[model samples]
Target: MKQRTKARSVALQVLYECDLTQHTPGQALEQRLAEEHLEPELAEFSRQIVFGVYPIVDKLDRYIAQHAPEWPLDQISVIDRNILRIALWEFAVAGCTPVKVAINEAIELAKTFGSDSTPRFVNGVLGSLANRLDEIRQQFQREKAQEEGLSPRTT
Candidate 1:
């Protein structure tokens, strides 16, 4: 697997463990990375993803619930939920990864780690979410602006 792909896989595993085991992100990631023995760069990338998703996990969950209302958050599989969170982080939060790349990587992850229907489910939800990414990003920026005591930028 490619570096980021491997990193995302590890990050997903870390997320799964954290959710199921109630372990700290650092603890989950450290344990998983130790077992996997990934390259330094890949490990660092996974670390970034785990840490990035940990803080705003509730926000991400809320966003997912808002977008994929048909699929209640609790009912979704742990693997799929974490996949969406990681992809959403890449798509709307970090904005470092390209949108298509993020969505495609998410689908790939679903195929590997999720159920038979997971890829399509992930694609549909993420596809819809990606369509509204700019709107979401703008809203996020506006919220941040308000918190910083500045008027939000007008488009």
Candidate 2:
């Protein structure tokens, strides 16, 4: 695995633990990283991806629900939900990571840690949702433009 992809998986494991135990990412992952004897550079990358998702999680969840509304918020598995959040944050929100890379990385994570069905489920939901991204763009673009005095109408 690529270094960053492995880092992301490590982060996902920490994040999964956080959800299960109700611990903060920093505290939880820091302890785990120390005990696991993980490399320093990879540890930092893992921590960043895990904790970094918190700030934008609410907004990310809203869009995720919009895309996958048939499954209620509570009904969705925490691991699946967090995976989508990480993938979306990197590809859709950050605009720095490529969509293909995010999706591929997520599939690997699911295969490693999620259910036997998880890899396919992860790809299906994320792939379908990611494909319908014009709506996501429209939602964010309009809001952002309005915030910046670029509303799409004549004064």
Model 2's number of clashes is 0
Tens digits of lDDT, candidate 2, 1-155:
77777778777778778778878878878877877666788887677677678756777788778777778867878888888888877777656578788889889888877788778877877787689766675666676678789865534
For 1-155, candidate 1 gives per-residue lDDT tens digits of: 77789899999999999899979998889899989999898898899899989888887888889888888999999999999999999879889799899999999999899999999999988888889898878876777789789997775
Best candidate per TM-score, number?
1
lDDT of each: 0.90, 0.77
lDDT score for residue 146 of model 2: 84
Model 1 lDDT, residue 9, Cα: 99
Residues forming the 10-long window of minimal summed lDDT in candidate 2: 135-144
What TM-score does model 1 achieve against the real structure? Answer: 0.92
